[model samples]
Every structure is written in C-alpha cells, then in structure tokens.
Target: MKQQLPKNFKPKALAALIGLTFTLNHASTIAQEAEPETALETITVTAQKRTQNLQEVPVSVTAFTGDEMAEAVIKDMYDLQTNVPGLGAFQSQSATNSSFSIRGVGTSSQNFGLESSVGLYVDGVYRARQNSMINNLVDVAAVEVLRGPQGTLFGKNTPSGAILVSTVTPSHDGGDSFVEATVGNYGLVNLSGATSISAIEDVLAFRVTAFGSQRDGTIDSVGNGSETGKNLLNDRNRWGARVQALYTPNDDVSVRIIADYADIDEICCGAPVQLSNATINPDGEIGSDLALPLLGGTVFAGGDAFYDREVAVSFLPESTMTDKGLSAEVDWELDENYTLVSISAYRNFESFDNIDTDFTDANLFGTYNDSKQSSFSQEIRIDYTGDNLNYILGAYYFTQDLDLDYSLYTDTFFNEFYMSSLGGALDDLFAGINAISAATGGAVAPVADAAPAGTGFDHQAKQQHESYAVFGQFDYELSDTLTLTAGLRYTDETKDLVTIFSENLADGSQSPEFFNSTTELIIGAGAAGVAAGNIGAALAGGQAPSAEDLAALLPFQTAGWGFQ
Candidate 1:
C-alpha cells in the first residue's frame, strides 16, 4: 500500500473504515444502556368482583395502594376526598353522623332509617353504618373509589358510588414487620405497626396490625368558667387493631379469617357564633345581643369564626364510637378458568354523642344520644374467566338490628331565658297555677316544676332490616380494546321499626297525659308547632331525632323563647 496508492483513495478508504468502526461501537453502547433496570408497576383491582388489571377495568375508578396512602398521610375515610375528585366525606360532631357524597349526591340525614348513598366495603364485607366506615386504615393493601351508580354490583343504597378496601393477605413465605411514628402541631402523635409471620411454613400464616393517634383540638374553649380549657373541642383520640390468619390447604383452595376492633373517644365539633346583618332585629339591635346577659357576657370569636377557632360552650362536646367485626372468606378454584368464593361476616357498632345544642356558655339546651347496631351478612359468588368473555354471579343476604336511646334536656337558664323573653309571662302563668292550686286545696298540682331544669323528653327506638339479593355482571369483548358490559341486580328487603316516647319533668317523672294534651294544642296552631311537637315527642320518647327535625325546631324554639 505504501508503494502503489492512489493520491486520495488510500486516505478516503482509511477514514471510512474508522467512521464505520466508531458507529458500530456507539450502537452497541446504546443497546446496552437502553435495557431498563425495572419495569412499570401493574396495578390490580377487584372492582368487578374479580381481580383484573386497573387499565382493563371499564368502570370509572380511582385506586391507591397502601404505600401511596401512607405517603399522602391518609388516615381515615375523611382524608380520602383530598385525592378522589368529586368525592366528599365529612365527619360531623361524631363519627356516627359522618357523610359521604359522590358527584354531589349523598344522604346527609342522621336517621337510622336511611342508608348511605355511597356504599363502603372492606375485605368484601359491606359496612352499612357510617360509624363503621370511619375507622383508621391499618395494614391496608389497596383502596378503590368507584364513581357513579354501583347499585348493580354493590346492591342497595349505592346509587351514588362505592368505596372498596382490601387488607394485606398474610403470606406463608417469611416474616415481616414494620413500625411507623408521626408527630405534628397541636400535639399530634400517631403510632402504627404491623407484623406478619408464617406459622406453619407454606401452609398457614398470621398477621397483626395496630394503630393509635391523638391530637389536640383545633377550636379553643374559652370564657366558659370550669368548661374553659385547651383542646376542649374538635380533638382526636382513636385506636384500632386487626388480626388475620390465612390457611392454604392446597393450591386450589384457600381460607382467610379476620377480626378487628376500633375505638374513638374524643371531644368534637363546636361552632363559633357569628352575627350578620340579617341577625338585626326590628329594633336595629343584633338579635344575639339580646341574650348577652343570659350568656354571662361571653363573646364568641369576632369576625371569621373558622379563622378565630374560639367557642363559648358551657359543656365539653363528647363523641365516642366502638366497632368490632369478624369475617371469614373462602376461595376455591373450580378449574383453570373458574373460581368460587364465599364470605361470611358479623359486625357490631356502638356510638354516643353528648353535644351542646345551644353552642353557648349558657346551659340552655343539650342532647345525649346512644346508638347500637349488630349485623350479619353472607355472600357467595362464582367467577368465570374466558378468552373473549368474563362474568360474575353472586347472591347476598344481610340482616341488622339497630337500637337507639336519645334525650334532650335544659337547665334553669333555659326557663329564665324564656321567662325574660316573654316579659314575665311564664312567671305570671306559674303564679296563676299556684293560686288555682291554693283555691282547690292542693287538689290541682300547682304546675310545680314550671319546666324546671332537666325537663325534656326521652325516646327509645328499635329497628330491624333484612335483605336478599342476586346480582350478575358480564363483559364481552368485541375487539382487542373494545368491550360490551351489562349488569343486573334484584333485591328484596324488609324493614321494621318500633318507637316509644315518654316525657320527663324536673323531678324525673313521666307526664304522658300532659305531653299528649300539650302536643295536641301545639299541633292545632300551625305546621311549625306540629313539627316541634313531634320533635319534642321524639326526644321525650328517647329516640334520636333526625337533623332536619332539629333544624326545624331550632328556629321555632329560638323565636318563641327569645334566645338562640
């Protein structure tokens, strides 16, 4: 080559060879680097009663894994709304009064007769009560929020949406444990832990999870004498524990048993009073100002009530809830493409709320409510998986018994407020009754009590609900990415309620005759009076009146008694 080389041919050939070698080396390096270390995670969900990839499900749903929830600091159902669009959840003065709404449709009524529009299911067991729906999530595997009517899959009272929660399944592989702690402002402290162990190697496993949290109240309680204190309203105190056991007798059959208990005891929910222009009376004086003397000159926070976070409550608001349940789930693989599942569960819930109805330093009125429910349910389903078609057929049975004891009472200040508002008319009436009694030689009891302190009504109610349903859904694939779906559910339900009412006097005596006569007179006056009488009767009978009843009675009572 050095002796017989064309002038430029040798140089050009050398350069082309070097360039080809460098291109080959660069392509080899890119091939090696393009190989990914990990692949994207695939999410699985059970929205259609069968495990399927999230992207494959046709329903409008949002899902979150345990790690995601922990990362977002989601502790309870109320925190779910922060991540779920068009979903709203609120815990009122008590967990028993919690509400969940989807797309602006929900049942906010605190009536036991009404069920939630948005259904809640945990580990495939339906939770019918709001009190049971607010428990802290522990050792959770996943949560799915399905929007729009889910009645076909979930049964009754799911016209709005559904929430599905799945707990971690104990593994027979090895032992794992974790503990987490959190601290924040307002004396917040949270501790949670989980432990899983293989009990019988490849055959049986067990898991335990527990959590507890406490935090100071956001609203300050001030200027309420002995009732004044920090963290007296809207505080948080709760704890829960769950135990699970899994038995895999063989590859084709498996069984899981779970038991859980949760409790919440806290002070909650007092609203600061705010006066607006509409509160001005005909005399150009703020309506609330008329009761300033009765309230002992106590002033709620001025300006924005929420920003101020100050309330003048004579009694500390109290809310307590307890929930416990046991469930057993069995899965049997019928064949390569079919599976059978059976679930049986029993649950109990109890809650109590003592609230300052007047929301003022003055002990005018208050409420005490104690509620309990026990429920049992059983479900069986068969799932079939086919290349071009999938379907689920299920039958469900559920029954529950509910009992409630409720009361309303007022103190001396209530009578005083009424008397002053009526310009001493109550005093005059009492005097007239005394004179009549004196003339009758005590034959007529001198309206002795004059609706004294602790005078109100007690209501007791019992309700039983039973339901049976058969539901089925199917998905048929028409193409690789397009599918047709259809579902149907038929339900038969029966409900029974028994309510008893009784009135209480200052001396704690029943006055059914007096109450009935007074209620009749009030009913004759107008619709408002009729509603108040009914509410009063409900209270006297020891029944928990609905919020609507209370709201209707509040204005009527306030206007008639001259104090709110």
Candidate 2:
C-alpha cells in the first residue's frame, strides 16, 4: 500500500525547481539526441562497509547520497521508506511508536523489549532500538539499505535486513549559508537550513544544521471540553539540530565527531470506533454487545455519525519524544594495502504517551505510558584490499538499559468485567427482585450504584542487555567476471529483565451498599437469591469474591491491570 505520509510530511522541495524548468527541458532534449550509450549519474555507497560502486555489489542494496536525498526531498527515514520497494513503515497506535517491515517481514507493534528484525547502524556503530533511528536526518553523507537477512556481517537482529547511515564529514571548501521556509494550508509550516565552514582550511572543518516543522493535526478531537482549534488533537510539532567536527591531521588519518538532539510534542493517533451488529467478540463469547442494552452502549464521537477525521475522546491526547546522541569515528591508514577503523557511539531516547483509548466521548478507558532506551557501542576493524583478495575483520561490543512502564485505566471496566464475571449470580439476584416487583405491576432497574469492577494496569519493567561479537568477511575475485564472498561471526549475548503487573476495583472493595443491592438483585431472581441471605450476613461471613474467585469468574480479567 503506497499510503501518502499523513499531511504532515508533505515536501516543500518545489522551490528547487524554480529556475530549472527550461534547463531541464534543454538537457533532456540534448540527452535524447545524444549517443545511446550516454553516461548516467554515478552513485557510490558504503553498504559493504567500504566504498564501492553500487552495481558491483551482489547484495540487494539501495543507496542515496546526502545531496541526492535533499534534492529528492527525503526528509526522514519514514519518507525514505515511502520511496523504496519492499519497505514498509508506519506510525503505531502512538506517535512516538512506529514499526518497519521489509519484503513481508516486519516487527510487531509496541513491543519495547523485542529486537527489531532489521538492524540500524550509524557510521558503523549499531543502534539498539529502531525508534531512535527515524528522526533528525541532517548533515551529509549517505544511507544504504541492504535487503534480506544480514546474518553474518551485522550479527543479531538482522534476520530481515539492515540500514546504514553516514552523516557528512567536514568539508574544506568555502562556507555557505541559506534559509528556506514553506507555508501551506492546514497551518503547515516548515523551516530548515545548514551552514558549513572551514576553521583551518584543510586541517579542520565544522558544520551546524537544524530543522523544525509544525502543522495542524490530522484528527479533530471533539467533546468533553475539547477546544475546536486550540487544543486540536493529533497535531504535529518537531524540531532537531546537529553539529559536526572533522579533523584530518595527515593524509593517511581522519577523524569526525558528531553530537545531536531532537524533540517532539504532539497530540497524535486518534482511534475512533464504529458500531456493528456482530453478536460476539472474537473469543466466541456473547461479548460486550450482550451488555450494550444494559450499559446504554457507547456513543459515537459524532453523536451517531462518523465524519472524516473526527474523533471523540473523554481524555486528552498527548505524546512527547526526545533523542540525543554522540559519536566518534576514526580512520587510520596503517600501510599501502591495510587500514584501521574505530567507531564509538552513545545514544539516549525517551518517549511518553497519553492516549484516550475508549474511542468515545464518554469516560471509559485510556492509558499513560513511557519508554526509555539508552545504549553504547564500540567497534574496531582492520581492512585489507588486494588485486585478488579483499577482507575485513572486526570486534564489537554493545550494552543497553531499557525501562518501560504503562498505566491502563478504564472507568467503565467494572461494569463490563463484573457483568462478564458474575453474570449468572447477578442474573439470579436481579431476576428474582425484578419478578417480585413485576407481581406488584411495576418495573425496577439498576442505578449509579454498587462496586464498579474496572481494574487498571500498572506495569513497570527494566531490562539490561549486553552483547559482544567478533566477525570477518572476505571477497575474492576468481576471474574477470567471477567472484566469491564469505563471512562469519562469533557472538555472545546476555539479558536480564524484571516486570510487575495488578487489577482492583474502583470503589476499592465490595461496599456495604453494593452488597445489599447485589443480595437484593439475587433475591429478585428467585431461588438462588433467597439462599444467599441478607447482605450484612453474607459480607460479615467473608463472602466477598477473592482474587482467586475473580480468576475463576472472569477468565478474561487475568491478563493485567493494577500496579507493578
């Protein structure tokens, strides 16, 4: 599916074509009239961890240079994925969360602890999480997307593929600066630019770049005091900056250091619900539809109608994300045919999400969540190239600390769960009581009373992962048109994790009034109600349901809720 990035990602590169219309026409005419064997633009990439001609590599790789990407208006990883065949990237239920897939292989959504199927690397240093890879695409250099499993070369988490990104190095050329801005409908505003300068000519150079964009959100959040425009839900606001320093003290040695930070705040991912006549939930139970009549059912956001981009949520929406990193790379020429390389990097990222989950104007359910990932990686490698043989060997070490916590709240879950949990008991009690009223020629119903049974989730988990690997790869040219390639890696990994999950009633417990009503409803149901006795006696006898009782009564409630 070629889904256009939501309205927020629209490109403003139209200005680049301003003075090229006639020139391009002339170039096209001349090229078409020239020799059939005219040369094409050359594209170079480091997909194999070395500079190489794109056509010479056997692996399936797509390479785009920094200049080419800017010209093509590819702003970020998500935009890059849109142009690649066999690549899929989409925002998950939260703006701060996203998923990627290549060639039908993809990572599941919002599973913070699971490793990505595709690996991500910046300047040869591996990144621990994919969420940290999508933003702040600035500076220079290139990106190489290698398809299929990079089993040996990249090590773990590459069963699907790998993405290699390189930022531009300091240039010795004279400095240049420019400012560009785009304003469009729907309050779309984008501004970005860069400046590069040489402090000591060929000896040292530095660059600074920044980008920011803001636009009206996609979904309109209405009802429950939601402002029509000021507090619009699903809005987009993001900005980031990067600075780089490059040093080349001698012809055989070069070093580059990069530091960057990015932040985003937005109300994103508004999910609306639609009503259906289906009689059952996927579990084969009569489902919540069975309780719809009693609960009065959910009210659609548009008051019985669903309009385009309209969402109703009783809870406010919010999402915040931040990323920071530092990296250093050095290349040293040891001799004529040999070279040494080292890459070290550190990164920290955090995201917070507040979502209105019930998908209605009524207060029902929602969630507050946070995830943080910080990691460090170091690698050193030696390269040798010869007429018939080329090889590289490297050692890598990586470590990470991850923390995630989620709080899921449901204001109406008590009714839903209790109905599902004590369906027979409630029916037994209420049936008899209603029958008693029926004999008096009157009907009685439930009120805003009793122990509402909703249980929320409080989960906090910590995970520590450490990995080390030694790997080598070689390529041999047997003849003019024949070649051989082989690679191997020895790896060790250790991981430790702990998580805590609980669910409880909103009213705290079986309040006395709730018990009285419950007993009365049971009595109304006839036989079973009479045997249960007065509410006081049953309660005093410790007859309230226990966690074990709930386990047996509400099988679906076993999942999670409460504090960890």
Candidate 3:
C-alpha cells in the first residue's frame, strides 16, 4: 500500500476501502484485546452479613451454587458430604433422622427436647430443630458451610459450625419453568420441578418449587408377617413444596413472602446387632450382660454376624414426620449508607414413632413418642456501610411451645433385672416378718407366694419455653490494612413443664389397652413390700407415688440451655 490511493482519488472509493480494511482487522484486534476466560471466578458470600469475596472473608467457608450441587448429584442435607471436608453424614432409616458431623464433632443426641451444636439456616432463617432442617433442598441458589464458632451473627451459637442454605429467590426479570423425573433401583422414584412467573412485570413475581420421592426399604422387614404391623427398617416416603413471592415497589424497597411444607411417612430406625449380653467377658474379664450375642448363631458367623440386607427384625413398626413453616422478609434502603431488614417467621414440627425397642421379632418391648413443637421468631436489624465503619445491629424475640408425649411399654420378659431387685426385696421382707413373729412369740399370717414377678411403668410429660434476645455486631476499618470486630448479646428466657409417672403391672398376656392400665404394680419402693418394710410400715409414714406428686418431677430438664 506504499503506492496506495492518490490524494485526489474519489473520496467514496477510499472511504469504502478503509472501511473494508477496518472490518477485516477488527476481529484480530478483539482477539488481541480480550483475555481468555479460563481463570476461576471468585464466589461472593454473606456469611458475615456483608458481601465479600469468599477468599477475603476471615472465616473458613465452602460455597456451592445450585448448578454445582446438581452436577454433583446432591439432593438433600446428607448429600453435603460430597464436598465439605471434615464432614460426615450417616443416612439413617429415615432421611430426616440422618446425622451430620464436622471434624468428628457433632451432637449424638437426637432428643427433640434439646438443641443442636451445629446450626442450620435457610435464607437467613434459623432452623432450630435438625429434624426440620433435613428436608430435601429446593431450587437452591447457593450453600455455604461456615466452619468454627459463628455465635456473633447467626441465630444460634454454633461452636461446631453452620450450614447455610440460600434458596433461589423470585426473579424480577424473566419467566421460566422446568420439570425432571428420575427412576432408579429399589423402586426409587424422584420427581422435581419449579415454575416462576412475573405476575406484574417489574412489580411482583411468584415462584413455586416441589419434590416427591419414594424408595424401597433397605432391609426386608417381615412386618410380624401379620395384619397389624408394617414392613420395618426401610426407606421413607417423602415430599415437600415451597412457594415464594417477591414484591418490589421502585428501587428503594423490596419484600419477600415465603411458605414451605414437608411431609414424610415411613418406618425407620434399625437397632445395631447386639454382639453379646451385658456382663463380664467369657475370659472371666467381663460378663456377657453388656454384650448380648445377637447374631452369634446367624448364617454369617465368624464374619459380621448380621447380614448386609438382613436385619432379622420381627415386629410391626410405624414412623411419621411432618414439617411446615411460613416466613416474611422485608428490606428497605434507608439511604445510600444504611438499610433496614425485618424477618418474621413461624414454624411447626411433629414426628410420631411407634417402634419395637428390643430389636427382635418378640413383642416384649415397645416405645411410642408423639412429639409436637410450635415456634415463632421476629428479628429487626439495621446495617450500616461507610468508608470507615460497617456494622449490623438487631433485636430478636424467639419463643417455642413444645409438647412431648413419651411412653415406654415392656413386659416382664426383659425386666429381669428389675424383677430380680423385686425378688431381693421380697426375700428381705420375708426374713424381717419371720424375725418379728419369733420375737413377739405370736403366729404371723402365713403367706406362700408374695406376688407375680413382673413390673412396668407409664410416663407422660409436657414442656414450654420462651426466650428473647438483643444482639449487635460492630466492625471498624481502623486502618486500610487492619480491622477490629466485636459483638455482644443479652438474652431473657422462661420455661414451664409438667410430667406424670406411674407404675403398672406387666402386660404380655393382657390386652394392648391393659398395657397402660395402672392397676397392678405397687407405686414406688414404699408400697412394693420391699426390704424397707411391709404394708404396716408403709402406711405409717410413706407417701405412696401419686399423680399429684409428679408435678414436682416434671421440671427435670435443665431450665436454661446453652446458646441456641
């Protein structure tokens, strides 16, 4: 082009050639200007109440998006083990009852009356109960695992760590719908879908997501091979749905209304194979009493006595769980430097189980637990953002009403230990009576059999609790490279409880209704004709066990539990 166009050439021709050359070279220039998108993108997290790059946060956290979880095939809380380091999940008979551990530290207690060491949350809502937190995850936006103590900001003071579940919020821009179905072995059927509609363009949006799954049992439960019982020690029938509404009135205000419900019905909980009875060993070291030989005579001997798919349980069992909740969250931009947020929620949880406790096909032992709980919480917070300081301050009020109906039924079959104690008491009483008769030089009423060697009991209880707290956290950018953080919380709480305990005779040969009938076993050691004395001595000073006296024992549980 050294001899290109002459200075007097047609302006149009020169312009067209230059334009063509520019177009041909534009792509090459773009290629030189644009860098490859190969570098990993940094994740943003709100674990600290402030948006920041994941790597920049001072806490140890692992984050995953909904797409990432889908790619990894993580469908529920238990599936979190796939990526969380130092974490473990034990899939029990019921998915809701699954256990989670972090660095081998987790609460082994499954008592509904207690709180967990690890905290679980959904969209900034604390799931106080683990049973309610184990439901199938719905269209999640992201999941964050915060390792170590997060007491300053979260609802509960979780020393073990926190599992934060952030579900996808209703979008204001578009509409989309998807449905998926999966079929697998053991009759596994899973169906999931979600739909979103911008009901009023930029002003209102609604989203609904739901899932249903059912699977065959892990063990072949014989179900007592009868009419009243069901297949035991199996998987669960589970389903859940979530609905959310997003309202945006201009750019300065936003509100979200959410409601969710989950229901599960299945037989669960398989007892471990008893190696031996509880006693000193055969080497005269420890008895067999502590280790009853459960599978010593099973087909698989010398190896793991119990079969992989064979639990060998013979009984009818029932297990069911229901969880439902509703919540609302509001965000108001006070200005460019401040924002106000309010989260109000109410939730209910209940699980009922009628199970065989002896782990055998025998009808000797059984237990029924009817647990119900209702809880409500309200939180209002103000967050500040400035060049020199950032902070979050909130006032929280939380209250929960709990009702636990627990009953244990067992015949004389497994009450041998208690019966032996009863026997010893009878023997001592007989000796005392003989001694009295000889000393008084009088004839005593001759007695042959004291009473049938059987014992049982019935227990019922109720609990209530209310708690309130005011908490605040402050972070100051003292300097560009150094920051200071501090926080504090104050709480006020009250609790009320009432429990009733009664004695009843063993009910093996009697009707199932007779199991709860309290007409037989003597109350307490006083009326049992034990070593202390007989009827005469008992009536002299002993206050026999009565319904009226049980009120004093109802508040046995600790009044104030630790942080959430």
Each prediction's whole-model lDDT (CA): 0.71, 0.65, 0.61
Q: Give the Å shift of residue 50 in candidate 2.
A: 0.1
Q: Between prediction 1 and prediction 2, which has the larger TM-score?
A: 1
| Model 1, span 40-72: residue lDDT tens | 455677888887777788789988877677667
- Give the top-scoring candidate (TM-score): 1
**lDDT digits (tens) for residues 31-124 of candidate 2:** 1123246675455567778777676787899877665666777767878986777877767556766767789797864778887898888767
- C-alpha RMSD values across all candidates: 17.8, 8.3, 17.6
Candidate that would win on lDDT = 1
Tens-digit lDDT string for candidate 3 (364-436): 4567778888989888899999888888998888788888776666533343333343556445544554553
Candidates sorted on lDDT, descending: 1, 2, 3
Query: Which residue segments of model 1 deviate by more than 4 Å?
Result: 1-41, 271-285, 295-297, 304-306, 424-449, 512-564
By TM-score, the better pick of 2 and 3 is 2
Rank candidates, TM-score, best first: 1, 2, 3
Instruction: Provide TM-scores for the models.
Output: 0.80, 0.77, 0.72
Return whichever of 1 and 3 wins on TM-score.
Answer: 1
Identify the runs in model 2 with alpha carbons over 4 angstroms from their true place.
1-37, 175-177, 223-231, 272-307, 412-455, 504-531, 534-564
